[model samples]
Target chain A: MATAVAKKKKVRINGCVAAAQAAKYADVDVITAYPIRPYTATMMALAQMVANGELDAEYIVADSEHSQLSIAHGASSSGARVFTGSSGVGVQFAYELYSPISGTRMPVQMMIADRTLDPPGDFGSEHTDALSARDMGWLMGWSCDAQEAFDNHLLGFRIGEDRRVLLPQMVCQDGFFVSHITTDVELPDTGQVQEFLPPYTHPYPLDPRRPVSHGPQIMPEQGPPLQLERARAMEGAVPVIEQAHDEFARIFGRRYDPWLEEFMTDGADVVFFVQGAHAVTARYAIRHMRERGAKVGLVRLKTIRPYPTDRVKDALSKFKVVGVIETNLGLGSVSSGGVLYAEACAALYESPTRPLVVSFMAGMGGEAIVLKEFYWMTNKMLDAQKRGAIEKRTHWVGFEE
Target chain B: MPAIEIQRQMLPMFPSPNQGARFYNPELPETEPFVPGHRTCAGCGPSIQYRMTSKASGDNTILVGPTGCMYVANSSYLCTPYNVPWAHTQIGSSGSFTAGVAAAYEAMIRKGKWKGAFPNIICEAGDGSASDIGLASISGALYRNHDCLIICYDNEQYANTGIQASSRTPYGGMTTFSPPGPTIPEAKKLFPKDLARMMAAGHPHCYVATASVGYPIDLMNKVRKGLNHKGASYLMVYTPCQKGFVYETPRSIDLGRLVVECGLYPIWEWNPEKREFDYSFRPQNMRPVSEYLKLQGRFGHLHAEHIATLQKFANEQWRMMKVELPAALIRAADAKNLVDMASAEAAAAIAETV
Candidate 1:
């Protein structure tokens, strides 16, 4: 076993390269792409890999994101392990396909380097692009850095293609933060990935011999049942996610909590709740605050849907206050803020010692929440604890007096 | 060759029902590829085409439906009518999606991932989806020469959206968006775009043809011929919409025959191997234009002069197909022979109570 494991090579690469490497390592049969912001580099790298004969794949340069997803769906339906990606409005342009792809159970994997949607066409990182597709029955979450992005891409395939959970995945990372930022992403050898993720074999594909209908028109009565099936698949994915992460850790020697990532919250008084790359920054801020005698920590949500509700309740129940750092927009939402605030507060509502949760609209519109903003948010949480209630429903971190 | 010899030699003598009232549904396979019990309206002409198309492809087939009534109305709430592996593609991605499916199958069969005879990959696009939004993608797929069959189920207008005018809608057709008012007597002034002919002319190498629901056997044979072709093939079929045409639901198949019989819809194929047009299809009877028009509400507002103009247009279409016009059709094209609906005193006297 030791010798077998030792035969697998590991090399350090950047996130975009790591994603392309993972796709190559998985021996993807088809790769569809359309150029957009941070995600374009991944396709560009894969295109070169195909040209160099490193990967034997059908590399299709699609006309648009809509075409990209459609091609991916078509290829995957024909029993090819397909890969594609997009960023920002590119994701939205293919919105008509998300439910159809998932409903057909194609198990197509889409890597999204999150970019803010335009009114302003800013090519900066924001969760809104991917977050907007949260309820589309896709297995979606964000990766903090390059290594995690690579592992998540591999794991996404396993979880998505699993017969019990035949759904597409939006394996995402923040634009420029993890998408462009270089990191030491340890690339797993082909043998390791083969052991970690078996080749995709859809039970009912578009095969001539064993034919089956996909994404067929359903009657009204049938709609609820299929939706229930999708819901059950999502709920059923919780155990599969944990099992996948456990298996991934066993194979690659990298451990991660599949749902909630807790940091220094054993005896902390206040915890900053967040997701994505901002969690790494918040970790540094929390450590600095700990040394300065502040009992503030962080709880980073790794998976947004099939949201780790119980884990979140247990992790933050000891804290007196929980501040959700929303890095995306929710223009006319209940909090007059972001969507995570509603989810975080809703999850905590069932807790025994439901902490006084406050939504801090920071890191929004692709503006990274800095250490100073973290400290400021913690002070607000501390004041809420002193006052025994949230001062307001939302707080604009840097803009407010 | 003489006209008599040409007609006698070229036309196949399939026995027509003696009563001229009997409808003959071709003997189809027992296989239910596209089954019944979907949300398509009571008598969907396109659904009829779909059933025929799928039946022709047999069991080893993959169907692609672009965003259209067939995808929406047929697949609503997830209760599928298809017994085979059917996929819904984007309206514009019909050709491209079908291309990918074909490519995947080609690679799979070669690589031994899928072990079987190659499945027939077919795309069914509505006229609105085909002639408009999806035209370029369809052209691209044909240009790429993917092994697939694309059928544009042309129902003249966009029927699923409640009868909006598509590029294939006929001249003076009264759709909701193209309603006739006092100022604009003819609702839609322009004639329908010659889509099938354009496709044939554009992609000469492809097996391009025109079929209608009026001729089910001919349509099915064309479908088989397209699929049997090694590379890409395109077929544009005239499928009448009862709601859109404002005609009786039972007359759906009748209208298909009437359009062709009146020389309004030409049925021909572009033989890619020979680089020639095969005008081998001939309707059972040659009817006057008024016999086809008086049945639909869209043409009800036509004046005598307008009807004569349509008759002239039909004669020209017959001339294009090299079909010699009978003397009656030539005389009908004259405006003096046409009768106004409001001034038909002889017809009114026949219906008088006295």
Candidate 2:
């Protein structure tokens, strides 16, 4: 069921600006942020929006990342739609609040422009920052480009604000790559956005007339029931996520697979399983590889939380081998690889005939996963399929002897 | 863009504590925000302070209790005693979390999103949390002028953690962490920080005040005044810790009164409207420092010189409050006028073995 599209203006903007535009269009009630690289640009854009009077909202420059998240949580709990973000260790700095915000079921949206966590002194994009919090009861995913990042922010609001699934969302984009790169982003008409996403209101807000205790300390025995209810909300978000995406596509004419994006899996013997902007490069590499009569494709993971176990199992089952491009750091993992390898391998563990899965640590430290590296990773997977076994479980793509 | 409408609250600006001269129950909101059947001690000062604060806040309130006795004991085994909305934040997040709640309400109530009068957002932090780890965050909240109230329920030391000495712990006071030892005979070497005055000096615009659980009506009134200030406010209440102070359970409120009377805890308010410190508060029946110190076992180890040192400290507090020191208090301020702790036998007999 599709509807007539609205007037869309094509504007060239960076990923940070795209996210700020999405936040502005969403008409967020409160925006709180602390300065961290890559993600700081988004706040800069938003601050300018507020300064220019283009956005009528409360923009608070928090003392720290912890305060930013706290402000976001408080604002959200008070029945205001709030937007805040951090990058790198800035994300880790606010680690204590991730659960409290989610546990309370306040739909706070955090725009994460992934930056390399420090000690290495790099400002490139890496998934580890947001990936580390994937299990913290937040709905999270990545966008390949600015347009998707913008669209995802809108979809995130709808999905998270739904009564059935009132959870916070992490709209992540790669640092510098998607966040800094300028592209032609189609801005939706304000009326169309209004029709798609309306103003947010929490059912149990801290209202003088209707007061409710949120995140109250529960007894040990009472813990299980509340946790189970939170689990239920997450599990229930599956239908809500699917419905929102379907509705998002119909209204905005931008359709996306809410969970996993399949680039080319038709009759492929081997494929690349990647996430974020790395998948965009994987697409180019796969197109050239296919022209060489190589049966290779790409399986880009969009949603990393409430992980699409059944869908991943079905789509990846058709391949003979899968190369998991982990743009994140997951030390002591099953594949001695990245964390995504475990999720991909777990979904395939119960398969009738599981493919040979190999981990390739690439696109880390904000370094681009070049076409040659994709070729190198593809050959590793193809070699595994032909040998019917992985020579090794994980490969540090450029480090392998 | 449409003209953003300004919403004025119809709620009372300050708390309406019932006026009385005697120890009568202050007219409080009917709703028991701090319900009974909690695990705080029989005469826990902080628990009593919690009751008064929650009563002042009423139904439309959100309480942020940093990790402390109020957070752990009051909500023991997940059995919360709160009738109104309450949250537990990290010890250091006392002010930051409260600032968040206050800022949220500001946007929500003003943005035509949330309806009704603004709810009171209050943070109840322990002395250790407020005067120690949470000082900067509290300063930040006050500096930002968020519409919230930050109350440091000062039990003198970190009583919840088995009486570890905190920055607010008085000089010569004994705690698990500051026991009288060979090198440090006076127990805690330094004087207690003048926290309320520090907050008032740092955040002059805030409605800052020093209060005590001993005076229920005044404490509740100050709580209301802070909440009604329409901006950030800080209150530090002298909540006696029977467990830590090693006093009789029944004397918790009595200790609260003795503190003010002895000038150890002078009650005063910072008037932001006139940008002045209102030192108009006066305690009835001024007593010497010995009257307050002799009641607590923690100070029982103090010698004549130590007690006189405390008296001197109390004198300083009175001077800051602009109160003339009484003759007995002035005499007690000198070691020569005080007995040598019965020639050191009391110090030897009362020194905690720990």
Per lDDT, the best of the predicted structures is: 2
Deviation from native of the Cα of residue B162 in model 1, angstroms: 4.4
After superposition, the stretches of candidate 1 with alpha carbons farther than 4 Å from their true spots are A1-12, B1-44, B66-83, B88-93, B132-140, B160-162, B197-205, B215-218, B246-254, B270-288, B308-337, B340-354
Can you tell me which runs of candidate 2 are displaced by over 4 Å?
A1-7, B1-22, B25-32, B76-79, B326-331, B334-354
Query: Clash number for every model?
Result: 8, 0
Expressed as tens digits, the lDDT of each residue in B117-166 for candidate 2 is 77788899999989998787788889999989999999989877888999
Candidate 1 vs. true structure, TM-score: 0.86
Candidate 2 lDDT tens digits, A217-319: 5567988887898899999999999999999989999889898888878989999988898888888889999999889999988998888999999989999
How does each model score on lDDT? 0.82, 0.84
Highest TM-score model number: 2
For DockQ, the strongest prediction is 2
TM-scores of the candidates in the order shown: 0.86, 0.92
